[model samples]
Target: MGMLGNTFDIEQIEVHKGPQSSVFGSNAIAGLISLRSKPITDNFQSGFSISLGDDSHKAVKGFQNIKISNFLKVRYIIDYNYRDGFRNNILNGMIDSNRKKELFSRLKVEFHPIDQVRILGTYINANLDNRYDVWSPDNNEQFETYTDSLGEDSQKTQGFSLRSKMKINEDFNLLFISTRSNTQLVHAYDGDWANDSYWLDEHQFDPDSTGYNYSFYEKNKRSRHNDSQELRLSFKNLVTGFYFNNLSEKDDAIGYLFGGLGDQADGRYDFKAYAGYFQIHHNVAKKLKVMFNYRLEKNMYKYVGNTYDNYYGDDLPLVNYESENTMMGYKGSLLYALSDNSNSYFSYAKGFKAGGVNQEPNLNEFERIFDPEFLTNIEIGIKTIMNNFGYVINAFFGNRNNQQVTISKQRNVGDPNSFYFYTANSTSGYIRGLEMDLNYILGSNFTFQSTFGILDTYVENFEYELIENVKTRAGDRETAMAPKYTASFGLKFEKMDYYFLTSASYKSKYYYSDSHNKRSSAYTLTNITIGKKIKDFNLNFWVRNIFDVKYTIRGFYFGLIPEEDYPNQLFESYGNPRHFGITLDYGL
Candidate 1:
């Protein structure tokens, strides 16, 4: 990802490191990112910012805050970004095969009707349009693609949320939040990545469609909607977790834009869920505290689909399948105050990932669903602060069952030349890691911080069928995307009205597929920023990937040509290169 520098409207960012499903449910398996929005001030405020960079990249953002009355206030934010890409399409010789464009806006309102009551409302809208060209041969440059067709990736999201806070009593308070959100994604690409002329001249094949160059064009769509409500009760030294429901339904389709052979495919995943959670925290002794939490949930899933092929006719019977599960999760912890500026804690947690319908139904027995997943985790940590310096150290271990793993062979349904991504359940796995964070300050003029992480993930038992004749031994193998080593270092400087910041991060190599046969090499990146602030106005210059290093974001094993001619090959989607940009912000 590229950096756009900091604007005037940002506050502190919070990062969580462990499994967050105990509080956030199933989606926080790895971790979670939380941004603390700036508070609405009592006075009127407005801000504007713009950024310009290499490769014709540009960004414009603005925010407005209005104090309508003593009891009401409103704020809104809008941002737009565009980039003319750096990669070239080797087949068509056109640049911007990897361009990006995005638009986002948010509105927030705060209302205070009574002395002890407060209400907040927020609405967010976002749209994204981008080009993706990643296919290439091994001998090509890093910034080139071999596809002869055009592709587009587009997405949009809309959200609305309401929150209420009330001081119920002196010793207890209540907080409630309700949200509704939806997201839609559309992906269209060339199925074969080769023009008809190439196929006709080299392989002596002709199709019915003659107006276009592509042999096959495919478009896919996915959409999701969610409605949730949460209520929290806070006491003097305790917090509460209440109830959850995930009545989820999926409507997805894949159809051809051209051609008749690879015509259409449709799929669906419908599910319902309900959960209840409870927690308690209390001081057991003078310097020690004990906490306990528990949760239980019920999940029901149904699968429905209609898949077709020209040769095989229909892949499935176009019927409905159902599965259901009930699971429990718990957490217990002990915390002790070692000193006035130091503390230590030990925690144990259990998490769950409910089962879901399958995307690919080509199995022998026609099993149409994967089982739910569960995890057991334990951790011990210490935190200390001494005037100008602070540090946190932690060690963790986790055991997992029915783990979900997605392996992409890049074969699209109905079309012989596209890609279909599917998820399946793995038997068992374990994860162990160590992490440390350090922060130091030098007389309010300089600040330094660093984080280091070491992780090891392995599957204990499972076997995955790669093809009709080949199956990968998935036992005792390292998991995908689990880099063994990762670290980041950052420094911040401030003097009189000027500020400067620099950061360096590193990640070790990791595998991209379930077979563990292919991997990405280790890489490091550096970024720097120098900015000046004049009261309500600010300006900055920044650069990312200063060393111009090459890295991979995604990789796949697939064949682009006819099955009889070319075998499956390794392909990669590369990371961004060196980028430099300047930003200006004004506040009034």
Candidate 2:
């Protein structure tokens, strides 16, 4: 649900895997991504693109479409990008400490007064500014950083949407949708990534030890709002829907801003949802088909929290919470039609997730409410085409109940950056998976592709306690970044307007946290592309990580070095090293 503009103004992209929550509801239970954008016809079009790279990368993108006659149509899109951050902040010599910037704009409209009605509208504007001085005390210096407060990640977003389609005469059909969004966020960091003469050489024998003079800063300001509405109806084989949602959030947090001894917090959250859905398909003969789906949801939540702790000078009280829940989801399927190309299927699903409230800031009462998690899935699939080759395969099994696990807490236990994070509820879990896709065509200009996956995740018990009566158990771990074999392969070559491509990807070995047992060590990446098309003008060249492989996407296992007095290390973040780019395009 976080998608805005430009994939060349997408026309379609659909990916659904496991648990669609009986037709898109509640986080989709880890599956679902659907987007469709390009529409607006009747001639008139335009396009543009430009890019250049190498640390100081820059880019520009565009699109346009118009036709305002018999029934109105319009479209426009824009994108901008900038980059200059390869990280080399030797303490403020400022090489744009991890820089990046982006802007996106979009607008679309279509209306056909009558002809059985149709209307569509959309508008969006976005901005994302990023810079977060890559944490380091040394992960073998991937690029480099010796921060003294230099970090930020920003966001600004605006959105709107409306849709409608009607044609109720020849056997029912109607649809409507509405959406709204707003987001503003800023995240700040630099919690002693080292500077200040390395804490005065680790306090050289107590040289005014204000705990080795640490300096940490944190800023978190966020605001979010969302609204949604949907209605649907269609004849023949049934389809029905109704949904409404509203969400609100606010947070303003500040922390440890150096000696003023700070730590302030404020929070508010609200959510509401209601749903009704139905789907059915039947034709159990001549190639077989059967399907059924159902959904019912109701959820409401609210929270308020406040805190202040100027180095423990008190004032940590004032909190309120509320919750309600009722959820149900279902699906069943069976399909077969193994001729005209091929097909096969079998499925079962049930998923739900709702129950939250952990705006962290000193919490107890089971770390401030957390519950509600469920998933059950079973699947089997197959698809095939034989002439030039095509294939797909899937196999899955899953089970989880009350699982949601994320835990962290540390406040001045010698200040390992005084961490805080929460989410807990783990009682059972299981997962199994297999997936594959392949394609090949060689007669008219060569192409080949492949994909692979296999996974297993487990965590059977978790009896928690961070510290307080000390109790712990995490029976058989292995559920943190869950990675066990993944692969990709590609090759392409075209003959008409020149083209070439190469790709590679792989991953294995993972575990960044189930709260400790750091691991990550399997990586591969390769990419290359070249293109040319001289009709409407197009040119391209690209290279990415073609041999520069220094992996680690994220890792953090505590300990902030006061000469190892804070031991438990393992801090990393590295990905993206080799890159090359060039692009130019023009169209009409």
Output candidate 2 Cα RMSD: 24.1
Tell me the RMSD of model 1 versus the true structure: 3.9
- Scored by TM-score, the top model is 1
In model 1, which regions exceed 4 Å deviation?
A: 1-10, 90-93, 194-214, 234-252, 256-262, 308-316, 365-367, 410-419, 442-445, 469-471, 561-565
Cα deviation at 360, candidate 2, in Å, is 17
* Model 1: per-residue Cα lDDT over 455-503, one tens digit each: 9998766666655546666656888888999999999999999999999
Model 2 per-residue lDDT tens digits across residues 1-588: 243435767888889888787698878875787778778888889898998988888889888898988788898989898887778887678877888887888899889989999898898888888878877776765678888887888788898999998997887889999999899888888787767675676444243665446667788888999999999998888999899899888988887732233488778899999989999899989899999888988888988877777666776667788888888888898989989889899988988888778865556778688877878989898999889999999999889888788876554444655666688888878888899999999899988999999988887768767666677776477788889889999999998999999999999979877766678898989999898999999898998987888888878876676654667678888887888889998983
